[model samples]
Target: MYEYIHGKVIEYNYQINMKKTFQFSLCGQCYNVLVKLNSKAKKKKTTRSPSPSISIAASEDRINKNEMSSEEDNKSEFVLAYKLFVKTADGISLPAKWFQESISTVDKFLLSVYNKIHLMTKDNTIMPSYYFMIFKTQKETGASTQLVDEQDFIKFKSEYTKLAARKSNIGIYVTILQPSITS
Candidate 1:
């Protein structure tokens, strides 16, 4: 004899607590419905993607080892630039000459900094887009920065430029919590 237990996955009672049992014997439509429900449950059980912040831990270890290696070898400009960036971002405040030469793409550098600040931000209401400034050099001053949307990549760049300008001595510092237009 065929039987069908049409109920929620959680409420389903099984002989050995196995809720996925498709009733061993059932009609074609009932079997289809069970298969569909199984798919839905599978989707719900899947985990969400990891946030970018999780990368910080790994990057930190790589940075520390690189620093030790840099001290041992006088050469290695890449390590030197990365160290300068890490220091400046960590509030050590390096001179502008160090940043004049390229380290990484400005976008990548800014995104890393933005991610760091975003993770530290206390206010849940303020999105990453809201925190920004345009870093301008002495020559390229007076550039405008606008927050475009939720992700607001444009606004982030603008904010970076402004901070870079202000700290033209060391390097720009753009924080997610800081308000560009305080009124």
Candidate 2:
């Protein structure tokens, strides 16, 4: 409590709005091999990776340290991850590749989910409920326990444009989202 005689108004203005949050959960299969990934694989340096813009590999240091980490103890390590529970715009909204089959790799899943959301969603801020993160999981429960940082949300938006340009032959149109509406 502030004394009315001594307290001066220093800060003002606050908004009351509940923003929907998005979150991702690891597929059991992806978690199985996430730790075994070498530096190259973690960086997604394989021939099949579409481009650096669409890549979502963890850093070299993490991969190196987790080199010998058995898949059994996945609850012990931290990795960058994101989630997208896609709500379509009344059709098969997912890309053609994903429409037929499920994603298997964490890197691929991260790229695909981010790409689709960036491509289709009007409001890009997926926070409080959904997020991109580097989180350590709980060993006892295999649940995310610690957060490192939020992944660069704007970077995903940029990647969507770059991917569309690079794959122009596929004829994907890039629409710019207004900055004020989304963070």
Candidate 3:
């Protein structure tokens, strides 16, 4: 069986063996599913692996704490670093590095980026509600994905840090949606 979500297709497999079960992979991680064949079927005990994003969030918290402490030692405030780009008619603009302090929510971070874009381009038509943001895993590959508003930002940063094999700033792409005309 296959499941589609957010432009990604997930493949699920059923194993016919002594223990009947299903397995699937999502977001580069694998998971096992237990099926109850009949009403009388006894529930099987199974252990689930921690979600990749959850684990990444935990690690990111630790990393953030360490970063703050080290920056304090240097008598400088710690800031979350990001590279921002706006997608326009021509193409994505050159990345601009933004260092933000004490932003915990995605909405607030996006608002800051929106304000920065407005200031830089002096575009009055750009509305905060009309634009959405995404994180690009690689600049050359253009592998971008939308993140949930909850804890996904931390997870994304953690993944980027791991991919770069060091502490690195995140790259955010902002795309503005045009208002629809109704006749």
31: Cα error in model 2, Å: 15
Q: What lDDT score belongs to each candidate, Candidate 1 first?
A: 0.41, 0.36, 0.53
Q: Per-residue lDDT of 1-183 in model 2, one digit per residue for the tens? A: 122111222333323222434344655443544444444454465456555554433443554355445242332322222232343333333332222224333455346545565555645554223433322211223433222222332233334345445542111222222232334
Question: Residue 133, candidate 2: how far off, in angstroms?
Answer: 13
Instruction: Residues 1-183, candidate 3: write the lDDT tens digits.
Output: 122121132223333342345564543112111121111123211434457567446644654576577445434323456667676534546456565555645666666777887775557667766667788643446556776554566566557557556654467777756532320
Candidate 1 structure quality by residue, lDDT tens digits, 10-48: 355544444455545655444555565466445545745
TM-scores, each model vs. reference = 0.23, 0.20, 0.44
Q: What is the lDDT of candidate 3?
A: 0.53
Off by over 4 Å in 3: 1-78, 89-100, 137-140, 160-169, 179-183
In model 2, pairs of residues that clash are 21-129, 21-130, 22-129, 22-130, 23-130
For model 1 the local lDDT of residue 106 reads: 40
**Candidate 1 ranges beyond 4 A from true positions:** 1-102, 122-126, 136-168, 173-183
Per-residue lDDT, model 2, residue 77, is 27
User: Candidate 3 clashing pairs?
Assistant: none
Residue 172 C-alpha lDDT in model 1:
38
Q: What range of 10 consecutive residues in model 2 has the weakest lDDT sum?
A: 1-10
